[model samples]
Each structure stands twice: as structure tokens, then as C-alpha cells.
Target: MQHKYLPLIIAAALSAMSAGANASGYRFGSQSVSAQGTADSNAAEANDATTIFYNPAGMSRLDGMQISAGATMVVPHSTFTDSGSTRFTHTPTGGTAASDYVPSQVTAPSFYLSKKLNDKWTVGMGMFVPYGTKITYGNTWTGRYALSDVKLESVTLNPSASFKLNEQHAFGFGIDAEFMKANLGQAVDVPGSVMALAGTPNAAALAKQIAQLGGNPALLGTAKDAHGANDGKDWGWGFNLGYLYTLDQNTRFGLTYRSSISHQLRGSTVWDFSKVTTDPIVNGVLQAASHKANSAALVALRTPETLSANVFHQFDAKWAGMADVTFVRHNRLGDLDIQFPGTAEGAEVIRQQWKNTVRVSLGGNYVYNDNLTLRAGLAYDESPVKNAELTHPALPDSDRMQYSFGANWKLNARSSIDLAYSFLDFKDAQINYTNACNPLATACTGNGETTRGTFKTHLSLIGLAYNYKF
Candidate 1:
């Protein structure tokens, strides 16, 4: 049974809450065409099983039974600069420096399915990622002190149903169960006097001081008690709603809305120092206390909501067009609070002035023969990261345009192979980061530098699906 479903798992390899714009907040766009044509319009015409990830109403158009399974390999190559003279330092010497940084390689995966119950109703289920991001800077990086590595992931399970009202209208709804997690750790390299006065007698004390300041184990190498922090596991649920309308024999329109979910992730967090220090006291005493205190500070996070509409038209037997537009509501994530187990310090609050965003797409399909088809599409996606607070490195998003090409090869009456390739071009942008002010010295804290650089990415997809009409 597992072997038979390996493809499904591979196809559903990735479904994060933070992918790009395709997943929930990620990118797992549907791969199905329209009823009257191939998928080439805005997000409105979710006409296939992939619609389980987009909107449920599209299920209403199915006849008896259908199933779809496929996979997507998402590859993104990114670079960053300490642009505004962003500060970073090399160990052993501990001097200020600057250099271009390259992030790690990322691969994302996905899966989907739908079924019809009767003439007036349809039911379906889909597992996909809608939110997740990660960035790992190489060794000898400049911003090593301020940041080094970040990882975030999110997934969703959707069960939906659609009802046909009359000949021209339909409605659909679904329940979303979501899970999310995040991991982060960075090094902070500042001058010695700044540290001496900051209350650390040596590297060991410095590690303790920083941990008290939410600093991770990236700073002091084998001397300080540097350790990583995990946001643990967060679980929550939301809902999806949509509508579809047929204008005539040749045209159809669709609209969908996905509600935002709030997660109060509850899990165990460990702050271990095996990598930070070899000294027993450093590891056994102060380090142990910090870990105990840190675990008590885990809390909640808010995901965003979105809305989209699509229009698809079958101009002729060989020619068809598709277009879609979508909007995201990010204002709901304005503030996040993590309470501490010790009232001596209280809770930590991170503020986010996230703004709404939009995406637009257009596409078309061509049938070359009875068993083969070709597809092409273009989309413009907006960035969700704000310039002011963009340095966490969990994400560095910017506006981009995607050009995609794909083809389908039918093997028999019930099976087919699908392949697609897409290239993303992004505009260059700058990031300026401000660290929390040092209570003792205000000079360097208030005086931070910026770095300038650029980024570009590409994606490849290969999927196989079995379809049986009964």
C-alpha cells in the first residue's frame, strides 16, 4: 500500500505555510486545466483535483470519480549583502568585515485528490504545504554575528465539498487543519569594550548574557554557552469558501476566500550547549539554568488570510485563455507575544506591521494531438517581507515574475505523465536592520550599517497522475 502511494507522498513532499504564493502562503498552485479549456487564467478557475489546494467549489464539475497525484521540485538560489555596512565578523581575529553571502538550496514537494458523490454534490481532500522558508549562510559570512541560519515549515490538510445550485452557479467550502514550526540561531560579534561593559567577564559570561537577551549559540564558539532555540510545534484550523459561475458556453468565472488561522504552538524547547562549551560549569551550571528559563517562553503565532478570483474562456477547440488575481490579508500578524516562565523578565513581544499583498496570473493551453497537450503561464507575485524588519533571514522576499512551460503525455486511457519548468526573476532590494538598544551603550546599537545585493531563482516540476473515469 505504501509503495502504491509513494508518488503521492513525493508529490506532497512540500506544503508549507510560507512557500511563496502558491501553497497556503506558499506555492503549490493547481496543475489542472478548465472544464471548457486548459488552466490559463487567474486563481479563479481551479478546475481540477489540484483545486483541493486552491478552492473546493471546482469539485462540483467532476462527473463520477477522479484522482490526481504529482510532485514539484522547487529550487531557489539567493544572495544577500550586509548592504548598509551590515556588521559581521570572523572568529579567531574578531574584526569587522563585509562580503556577499549565498543561501542554501531548497526543494519543495506536493499532492492532491477529488471525488464526486452525486449529480448535485462532490467531496475531496488535499494535503499540501502553504508556509515555510529557510536560509543558511556559509562560513566566513559577514553578518555571522547578527544572523547565520533560519528554518520554518507549515502544512495543511483540507477536506471539502461543493454543491451545484443550478445550471450556471455553484458553491463550495472546506475545513483546514494546519501545523507549523520554526528554528533559528545567529551569532553576534561586537567590540570587546561593548561586551566588557555589557556584563560578561569572558566568552562564557557573554554567552549567558546574550541568552538572557534571546541570543543563540552562534557567537562564542567552544567557549560560550551558545545554543539554538526552537518554536516547537504549533497546531490550528481554519475554513475555505468559494463560488463559481458560468457566463455562457464559452466562458466561466470563479472566486475563493481562505480564512487565516492562529496557532498557539505547544511543544518542548531545548537549549543545549554541547556545541557552545566544553567546561563543565559553563555547560552544567549557567547553561542549564538558561535552558530551563527559555523553555518557559514559548507562545503563539498568527498566519494570514487570502482571497482570489479567476476567469477562463474556451475561444475554440484549440485555443483557450485563463486569468486570476489574489489578495492576502497580513495585518492580522501585527503582534506576537512569547511569555517567559520566570516573571523576573516577563514576556517578549515582537511586532510585525505586515501589509496586504496581491498576485496576478495569466495562462493558456494547446492540444497538439489526441494524447498530448502543452501549457504556458505567467504570474506576478508581490513580496510579504517589509523592508524595515526584514533581517531575521527566515525570509527575504521581493516582487517577482514567473514564466512557466509544461506538457502532458498520456500513456493509456487512465494514466499520464506531466512535466513543467519555471524561472523567477526578482528586482534588487536593500535591507537595513536595527538591533535592540544596549541599555549600557547606545552608540553602536543605534548606529547600524546596511548591505546591498541581488537574488534570482528557478523551479522544475515532474509529476505523474492516474485518472479513471467511471
Candidate 2:
């Protein structure tokens, strides 16, 4: 597709901003097999057969029919304090707002299942979310022109199989069907006086010219407002490869690789908002112009690739331990492309300068009596987006640590229930931007402003598994 200038500018604006409070954007990946991994020494090592996601090759060690399902609900809070460098001249909500930011809460959900077929093969299917986030700010927010709210969601269906080649080795493979959707909104500055000048068919033309001169502080009288509305949903496919090795009667090792998937989002972009509310603009144009309410834009978002290795060790009769390390090629996130329709010249735009991230987890389980078991785990995940360029509200990202606890209760013989919960703590990070943000501007100035703060999250999970031994 040919690149369009306007759409690229908008796209660049959207990509530079890190999604704020929503997990749909940059939260930690969830675990559905929370029970199996929650148990003993293997607990911190391999955890359940769900290790297929954590370590696919590990599927070779399971016997009989093993099915696992669960979900993680995450709640996040964020705060921002502006630096002296950034300054807002006016706001629709009134006054020169100082120190702008918002806080958010949401639930990120996920689940999975697996079964062994004969002695040589095993088949499994899992349902889970891969990416998403949500961010919202008060109307009077200082950076209103830069951001307001962002929501993104991506889910996946994975079907997998494994083969045991010998007592010491096994291999497995899985294919992923991914579906994703996104919603974005932001505020922009337009001359309040232009509203009166936009009376005739010249509204669209005038709106374009005004947008070009928007960066001029001396010309900026009162802050007139506008919003960006876009939602894109589509599907893509990818694959996972895994291997497992048995070192001894009580020890096992596994590794897995998840390839990256690229998504092209085709959606509508709407620009709507009055030049001013009931409150009159003190200077500049007072008449608001009505332009085409909608436009079209496309976004190509990347899902990073991952490599993980794990070790499981069983000790005595009641305890097991497990540990895992994951490396993700998030550094590829350095920039994202946004495409516009053929009619919209300069179609492609790039945003963000993301870096790579890594994750590490340790867990353990204890067998108490015969029908009940206890589990616990800890993990740390790194962030790809840095502080300075962070813009979008949908993907509020930062490095985080997770502490999880769960258990299984067996009923009769073939039925059982699992319960799990996780606490996530995100390090506080800062954001800085200014009028220079408008890609259409030439001579944009004002110390790009800055905001300081952090975020915290909580997640909960509940599941049921049915077991049948042949």
C-alpha cells in the first residue's frame, strides 16, 4: 500500500505513546495450567503439563488424559505528575491544568487444556489472551491533545501435539490462531476563533490549514478540541516448537519457542468534537467547522517471539520444584507501521522505539494428605517501552513482579477444582511530550513536558479439571 501523510502522522502519534492502564496492551502473559505448576519441587521447575506454553517439549512426560483450564484477572493503577518543562495554555474543561495523568483498573483473562493419546502422542488445546490494555483520563487532563483513552485486546487458540521418541527424549509442536481488536481516542488543539470562520463548504479545507498552524503558541488563544476514534479487529497465525529431555528418574528438562505474528488492522478513524463547549473561547476563531466525520487507517502491530527453558525436579513423595527463564525479542518493537487507504496519501507512519524484555519464574507445590494440594510461584517481567516517548493510553507498560498462589481439590475420583490468584507490582515510570508532538507542525517548541509516577496490579483465577485414567 502507498503511504499517506496525514494517516502516517496520526499513526506515528498513536505508536509513540505507551498504552497506560490496560493489560490488553502491555501486561504479563497469563497461565492457565496454574494448578499443575503450583504443586511441589516440580512446582517451581515445570509445573503442570501446561508447560507446553511454558515449555512445550514438557508435554511428552504426561501420562493418561490430563486437562487443565484457568484464568487471570488483573487490576492496575497509574498516576502521573507533570514536570515544570511542560505547560498547557488552555483546556475545554477550563483553566491551565497543571500536572496531568490518570489511574485505571481492569481484568486480563486466560485458559488451556491437554490430553495424552496412546504412548507415542499427546494432543492439547488452550484458550488464552496474548496482549491487551485500557487507559482513561479525566476530561481536564493536561495532555488531552496527546491522549485520553486506549483499549486493545488479542486472544489466541492453540492446538498442539507431542511425540515421545524414547525414554529420554520427546518433541512437540503447536499452531496459534490469533484474534485482536483495538480502540483509541485523544484530544487536539484547534483555534477557537476558526469555529466562526468554518461556516461554509470551506470547513474541511480550513480544518486542514488550521491543523497545520496548530503548533503556534502565540497564535494559540484558547484550546479548541477534537478527538481520534479508531477500532481495528483481525486474525493471524503463528507456531510453537518444543523439546523435553529426561536427565534421571526424578529430573526433567524442557525448552519451547514461540514465533512472532504480525497483525494488520483495517478500521475507521473518526474526528469529531465541537470547537468549544458551552464555554466561549477567549481568543481566536469561535465558530466550529464540520468536516467528514470519519476516515480509514490500518495498523501493523507485532507480537514478539519468545524462547523459554525449564527444569523440573521431584523430591521424596510430597514435594516438587520448578524454575523457568524466558527471553523475548521485544527490541523489534522499536517502531510500528500505520497504513492509510489509497486515497489518503503518505499511508505509512512509524512510532515508538521499544527495547527487548525478559521474564523469569520460580514455583513449588506440596501434597497434603491425598485429596488436597498447595501451590505458589513468583515471576518478574521486563518492559519494552521506555519513559520519554510513551504516549498512547492503551499500552501502559513497565517492568513488573508477580507473586502467585493456587491449589487443587479432588472430588470423588474423576472430578476436581483449581483456584489461583496473582499479585502484580509495576515499577513507576515517567512520560514526557509537548506541542512538538503534532507531526504536521514545523517550528513546534516548549520544553517537551514530563510526568512522574508508577502502577500496581492484582490478578485472580479459578478453574475446574476432569481426569480419567485408562
Residues 98-187 of candidate 1 have per-residue lDDT tens digits of 232322234444556677888899988877666555555532354443444545566788888999898799889999998766554544
* Worst ten in a row by lDDT for model 1: 1-10
What candidate 2 gets wrong by more than 4 Å, as runs, is 1-27, 33-49, 84-109, 191-223, 275-293, 343-350, 390-393, 434-470
Worst 10 residues of 2 by lDDT: 1-10
- Model 2 Cα lDDT, one tens digit per residue, 1-470: 11111222222212212332212125336545353234211322433456556655566667666665554444444455444322243223232343323323344444545677778888777666666554555445655545456555667788888888998888889998987767666544444234333454554554455556552322333445655556777788899988888888778887789888766667776655544433323122222322223567676656668777777787867987778777777655655555545332233333456666677788877788689887787877776666655533334456766677777777756656666666656665555433332323222211122332233333333333443333
lDDT of 1 at 85: 37
For candidate 1, the clash count comes to 49
Residue 335 CA error for candidate 1 (Å)?
A: 3.9
Predictions in order: lDDT: 0.53, 0.53
